[model samples]
Target: MTKGERAGADVAERAATGRAARDRLPIDGHGVFRPPADRADPVQIVFDQEADRLPDLLALRHRRMRASPLAFYRGAAAVMAADLAGQPDSGLRTQLCGDAHLFNFGLFASPERRLVFDLNDFDETCPGPFEWDLKRLLASVALAGRANGFGRRVRAGILSGAAQRYRTAMIRFAGEGELDVWYARADVDDLVTRLAKSRRRRVTRVGDKARARTTLQAYRKLTTVIDGRRRIVADPPLVVPVADLLPTVDRIALEDRIRTMLTGYRSTLAEDRRHLFDAFRFVDMARKVVGVGSVGTRCWIILLTARDDTDPLLLQVKEAGVSVLAGPDPVPDPDGEGHRVVAGQRLMQATGDIFLGWQRVPQLDGRTRDFYVRQLRDWKGSVAIDELTPRGLRTYAELCAWTLARAHARAGDRIAIAGYLGRRGRFDTALTEFAESYADQSERDHAAFRAATKS
Candidate 1:
């Protein structure tokens, strides 16, 4: 057969695979959300994750999670993973963001210095049924809309519309050339141009804030000159220097161990990136409390400087644990969980951090842990979900959905998945129903969690 004929045959085979998936699980089957009779206690599950996290920061994590149902949902990816596991999937596999909440989508600088919108978190990312991500995203949309006081009808429209965007975007990708699909991205400037005048002002302000969040900005905000030496400012429970975290006798030893870990992490990067990393010398390190979900996890911000204190590079060393979506029997990963996060992030994002790397380190607590390292901040900013109007929220959710579809298309079988969704609103309707029901479940779980920790 000719090369053109072979390509045609491949497309047909993938389309057949997608259509056959419908037989295993019909489109409407997605609407159902019957909790298992022996479902795990969601509150207990949230506490269970605290076992490996920093004990000193557990209280702060609890406080953050207890803020609202939406906040609780953000930190309760494990709770939702259990529920998603109880359902039958469409068997369409993709590198899932696992925690694809609405807030996870944001503006960040691309390698070429242009701002782009895409999924930014991948702590729980792993390969799984594609709808698992869709479900996670849709539920967040419902929760966010409800939190913003949008009525049921408005929330429903947003949910369905978001799902519809994912479905239609996948269909379009299915017909595009491989290169076109792979190179597709959501440019923030283009997005602003597409919005109405009133909305443009809001989004442009967000874009400008993100642009100002460069490493230099972080340097000024997070550091101070103390006795002719630049040091990370201590903010107690939120940000504490390593020296404050340990006794003077142990500080030097801990610094030595961290330097060794950095060397190991550097080996994981490409030779060119390693050369770029070599220019910076370690200056100071600190433990920082970050995000609603990642609060208790071990997170360290390492300060590296080259060409004096003015040129500073901050790297975040965040713990990477077993993905909540990992199956009963996960494949052995020699490079460990940290590698899992870096691999998934590279696959899903159009532009990744130049310093992205991973390492396994033996901790002072007498346990070995995996950690992924990356630039602490690079023009990263998320729109205030609470500030968005109902229409704005809907638009943002749909943009997230489209961005997700592009990510999935780059990592999964776009043709097959599109074939499964077909050309209708059935999948969208079902997804909206499931999202509302799951949001209700999350609220109940949040109440239980609040009651358990009310003391």
Candidate 2:
């Protein structure tokens, strides 16, 4: 067998014997990421990140964050990354979502037109301990539950339920060959059918809403035909036309630059995909405000029309910066951030955006910024946590667990991780406790952030 095939064979043998001679880490130890008495100030970390983003949008980002502590935590992936530096790990690494909060899990269309549920965001994605993503996900559950005014016991139960499901799912995935695990997909319909009547109804509604978000709907809503020219409608802060953001002279030049970048982006696609992509003619481009954490970054929507004017496609190209997990101890990532985002995304997601590609654009100031491009809102949808009851949260948490385990298994040594997790409840219980305590810490940090920003 080839070396890689040999490695897989070795791992399969190890799993069959309960990871004989593998490093056996204690389950309880996953819970211990004790912040030094002098942990980094959360407010300062927020400002540090804000410094590199668009200036005017910082106010909007801060406003969104102040709405709730979970909102704050959603935008504070860097702060958590710094804190996770102190945590013990299984020594097994995977391409991390870096910000694997509950809100980041969503349903999106696969290339085959099937809707699949998986991790959605990848701006800060990079290689890190598998547990770091798990920890971040569990903590988000606690914070989100608290935001909905769920009781402490209810919130803790959500974390416990989620962790247990992750352990169970990992064990299941471990039993399969690596290639078999890689081919697995978490189809949204399969998920919906398995739920109770109440959740099934809710998920069905979500599917309906997602189905309605077609390219035609987007074009009709966001574009207008003026004379013979189709143009993106100016929508102020939310969806500003490129002309609104720059003078006429600069607008012409920037559009030219973007067109050139698109050429580079097209080259990044596979040969077969590039032939398909070439069929779409560029129509217009606009700056778009997107997401809680991604608020202040440079995000643009590119509209393309197929041979017929009625057929439309929307592509979103957003700036990619250094991953939050590119800390002192994590795997090094000094190359292209755009490639970093795309590689991690492809590694973790069962299926990915067909148009996904990366490019670096030169700025007016003689610098270049990395960016990754993908289809915009391809039947994309997320659960409304505030609308969910405590029981609904429990069900959703389990779904997140199943999805995350599949993602982690795709990138890391599934046999070793599953063996480290074992077929037990000890790790699950410890993680739930850790999540609850971390939620309390998040609230206090949120208060400090509010005060610091106010001052």
Candidate 3:
């Protein structure tokens, strides 16, 4: 047979796979959501995750989650995972940003030093049904729109439009060459050029802010000169220096241990990046409380300097745990949790930080934990969800949806997934309904969590 015939046969097989998925669970069936009779309590699920977290910081994590419903949702990936497990999916597996909420998509500097918008957080990243990520993203849009004081109708439109964007983008990706699809990225400059004059300033301002949030900027804000030595400032329960954290332990010994762990982490980077890392001398380290969900986890800001205190590099080493999306009989992953996050980030992102790496290190409690490391802040910024207008929310959702589809296409069978969605609005309609329903459920869960925390 000719090459043309072989290509046609391959397309036919892939399309058939997608069509067959509808039989397992019809497209419209996705709209349905009824909490199982024996569903686990959402609060309990979150509390269970705290088992391995820092005891003192658990209060801070709870406080952050209690700030608002969206805050609770940000920290409740485990809860959503349990709820999603009780539902049906398309069976099209992909590398999922397991917590693909709207807030998780943001702008960060690429290796080429250009601002690119993509999924920013990967703490829960793992291989799973592609629809799980889609559902999470849609639900987040609905929730965020509601938070922004948009009416139900407006939220519904945004959710459906976002889902449709995902479908259309996937279909487009299905028609592209492998390399073309892999190379596609959401460059911020191109996004700004496509936006209206009225909206361009807001996005441009966001980009500018991200660019200003460099390592040097962080050094000026988070460090102070103490007796001719630059050291991380102490901000109890928020940012505590290593010396303060281990008052009884010898400061030099602790610094040596941190350097040792980072040495192991450096081995994970490319030879060129390793050379780049070697130039900086470790000056100080601090335990920092960061993000709504990541508060209790072991997160450290390692301050390194080159020439003078002004020339600094801030590396954030965050703890890595088992993904909420991991199944009972999971796919064999050779690397530990830290590597899992690093691998997933590499798979989903067009370009990543040169300093991104992973290592398993012994903790202060004498237990070893997995950790992933990257710059603390390198041109990172996210839209203010609470400040967006209805139209802005819809546009942002579309951008996020398109980015997600591209990420999924890179890892999953795009032809089959696109074939499943077809050229109809059935999946879009169903997903919107699911988002509305899930948003209500999340509110109720947040209330329950708040009551539990208070008790």
Q: Pick the candidate with the highest TM-score.
A: 1
Which regions of candidate 3 fall more than 4 Å away from where they truly are?
1-9, 248-251, 328-332
lDDT of 3: 0.89
Kindly give the stretch of ten consecutive residues in candidate 1 with the minimal lDDT sum: 1-10
Q: lDDT tens digits, residues 1-455, model 2?
A: 22274375776664643343234446777674567898988899889888778888888898888878899999899889888876666666767888989999998889899988899998888777788889999999998888788998888788889999998898899888778899998898887878889778999999888878877888889999878888899987889999788899988898888888889999989999999999998888999999998998889999888977788888999988888888854454454788899988999999999999998898832578888999887888888988889999988888888888999888876776777777778888889888887887888888988887774
RMSD of each candidate? Answer: 2.4, 2.4, 2.7
Off by over 4 Å in 2: 1-9, 12-25, 328-335, 364-366
lDDT of 1 by residue, 289-361 (tens): 8899998888899999999989999999998988988855667568989999999999999787888999998
**Best of the two (2, 3) by lDDT:** 3
Q: Per-prediction count of colliding residue pairs?
A: 0, 0, 0
lDDT of 3 by residue, 1-455 (tens): 22244356688788788889999778998995779889999999999989989999998899889887888999999999989988888887889999999889999999999999999899999988889999999988888888889999888888888999999999999999989999999999998998899899999999999999887888889999899889999999899998897765577787887789899999999999999899999999999998887878989999998887667899999998889888545564566689999999999988899999998877655777788999999999999989999999999999999999999988888888888998999999999999999889899999999999994
Residue pairs with backbone atoms closer than 3 Å in model 1 (clashes): none
lDDT of 2 at 16: 46
Give me the displacement of residue 146 in model 1, in angstroms.
0.7
Candidate 2: C-alpha lDDT: 0.84
